[model samples]
Target: MNAPAYENGRLALMLNEPRLPTIGRFWPEFAERSDKEGWQASRLLGALLEHELAERAKRRIERHRTESHLDPTKTLATFDFGMVPMVSKAHVTALATGESWLEKGATILLFGPLRAGKSHLGSAIGHALIDAGYRVLFTRTSELVQKLQAARQSLQLPSALAKLDRFDLIILDDLSYARKDQAETSVLFELIAERYERKSLLITANQPFSGWNDVFPDPGMTVAAIDGLVHHSTIFELYVESYRRRKASDKQSAPATITMEARQL
Candidate 1:
């Protein structure tokens, strides 16, 4: 075994670089073949780095998909369609397929019962935009209003609104889910008035405009809210059942989703 001193010399040359994990894993073999495969190590190292970079990009895209649309807090897999509006599909297809038409600030709305697919549809549209590499944002109606107020309280409301405008499509989910105080209602109207005819908007609400008085409190504010929201909006009224309860009834861990139109008018 001690007869070949040349073998040890060849091993030393191949083992020269110990930094690369890929190379270190095969160090012994590489060292043995140093003379015949001397240039191969450098080429192999380059290839390894390229693969790693590509994988990293893939992970980043996936994270964006989840964060921007799916909402890391919600699960799309749990969306149930058993209670989706019958006519919801047509409007959704128009929005999803005709995203190009959104440049002029087309609007979409979802008015439905609790446990219906309002937020789901809104998020789904947001997800579609994200898939197309377009900018999108989703926020609960109450939460976004609170954020705007918080920004104003901190003297940064304008800065916050500027970022809102950056997104091509913004989904305001669960707008009337909770009763709004007078101040919150006024802030909500102001935000709507600003976004009106400026960008594509998706709003989901359980209460119809006729019930607006309860939330807006002021008759004038109610008119303002409705005018801004409906002037350039596609309104969807979902009279469907509770998709969530449907799943509960079946005792199926998996949910079945339905996408249908609520009504045109």
Candidate 2:
């Protein structure tokens, strides 16, 4: 091959070998613009590196968000703080940063009745943390427990738990659904114990600590699990009426109110 063709081949090989695909794909356009604009070498190199870094960050966040399995519609922006006056918006905003609490591997517990937005709040926090560059996994409590139990039967429980360590936070939605069985609760306890002070957990449950005995079956295991989770935890109790219930009531009343207004007219 000619000198220019050989040089181009070498450049392609170098970019591909290092897996700098973003820079490789965009650098040519950047070079064309730079030459036309009389840009210095350092300025062109800096712009390319910055663009590559930004693209990598964007891709990383998107990949993590997909793996997190968070509800796309539930976010801090969509949550109505007015309905739940007790939950401090400012406090939640701080937690979303994933700095002090997440770094210490703390737990965040959300307790409320059904349809009270516990899952949405937990998921919103998960999404925020993921945006802040933390890995998060959102899963139903029963599903994860069953998975862990199966791994235990296959004697791959340790490996399974180790795989979860990559996530900075794990959001266990609907913790009240995990069966009150020894096998199921045992694995759940093991997971809690494993992540204790090592990785964060965000759990949304219908029942409070007092009712967790219905989930653990064994008193000792219940205490142990609660102990680990509550040690370095931030707990939120949502005391508002069910969001779905309220919305349904509003819809039911709207027609009645309209009918009364029509009669008055």
Candidate 3:
């Protein structure tokens, strides 16, 4: 075969291989650059391999983010840290990196009243973790509880919980919604037990531990669940007025403020 035919054959073979698609797609352009620049063989090979590695990393991060179910709009940049002065921005920023805590399978618990941005903060951390190459899943606590209950009914509870092990962290949004149901709470406790010390959970709840009896109903279960979660956990209590209420107040004053400004003009 001629030189061109031989090169084409190699490219075709690479394209057929599962792992070489990125390299195959970009090799021709890289080869052209190599020829034009009079690059050494090692330089061309290193450049092509580096490009493939970077593209692979990007694709992996995107796939994990999609599977995470994190809200694209709720990110660290969009979170108003000033609103919740108690929750330090620097602390949150460090946690978002998923460095030591994730490796230790520690839990992150956010306690705050409704509309205080607990879910938003949890989701923002999840997004940041995903960008740092950690797998995460964000779901409403009630929804995930329902799914687990169904899995239990179908004799697939273990399987369902096992499937969740793929994620490095699971964010359970609005834990209060699943309160006072024995069946739901049972499965939730089971999940907490299963992942105890083995994986991480990020839970957002409106109620504190003192009020968890309303959620678990069974005191023993409540204590056990709390023990499992809190043993290796970081808790943040956000005592702030509701963001929705603040917005409404601002909105109500806008028209009057506009009128006053018009009078001044």
Candidate 4:
């Protein structure tokens, strides 16, 4: 049946219902379906509200992801577990889901040499957490320190740290890339202290704990930083050959790479 038309062609107003106009405009199809299905008024309202809430939640997640600054290309689906034989697929899978450790504000430390896929693993986990509706931020350690240093100069360091606190997990990529000077390392320590036991952190480094002194000039500071990070952390030492090197080796072994002079015969 057609709705009775009023002077403005909006019979919803005749019921003196303000919410009905919004409902009709936003969910016209659902309104028509409810009418056709002869649904109970209370039930229809509940269903419409639930749908609106779900859509709102989806929008919020998308917005959070965009503000997270995570790399779009890195995801759990794209990470190759086969390439990294030392890593346990079951264990990484559990962590990637971001369910278990996120609640406890635990840290994930990825330590390995260059080209060992440490950054890739950290970004993958950060991406997964974003997909799971958790806020995440990815930034190079040196870059983050520079930003913090600037914030300190401008007398906004506390607010800068506060802004970072909004994220549930912060992926600090290439922690070893930062210089081990007093000016740089102090801000880094401040960040760790602020986030200690409060928010989760995922750090990727080409150096192990023993080599952290190379990243923190003071030995005492190095010990303190390592102590804070490892207290409730899941550490992964990816002791494997470089994936890029292995791929290059495989290409060299392939028949397709035969010399042109040999083919000329």
- Measured by TM-score, the strongest candidate is 3
Candidate 2 local lDDT, 68-185, one digit each (tens): 9999999999887877888999999999999999889999999999999898899899899999999999999999998999999999999999999999999999998886588779
Candidate 4: the clashing residue pairs are none
Candidate 4 stretches with Cα past 4 Å from truth are 1-26, 244-265
**How are the candidates ranked when ordered by lDDT, highest leading?**
2, 3, 4, 1
Residue-level lDDT of model 3, residues 51-136, one tens digit each, is 88999899999999999999999998988887888999999999999999988889999999999989889999999999999999
- The lDDT of model 2 is 0.91
Candidate 4 lDDT: 0.82
Task: Order candidates by TM-score, high to low.
Answer: 3, 2, 4, 1
Candidate 1 residue-wise lDDT, 167-189, digit = tens: 77778887775467887667677
TM-score of each candidate structure, all chains considered together: 0.66, 0.89, 0.90, 0.83
Instruction: Judging by lDDT against the true structure, name the best candidate.
Output: 2
Clash number for each model: 9, 0, 0, 0
Clashing pairs in 2: none
Candidate 1 — worst ten consecutive residues by lDDT sum? 256-265
Cα lDDT tens digits for candidate 4, 137-164: 8899999999999999999999999999
Cand. 3 TM to true fold: 0.90
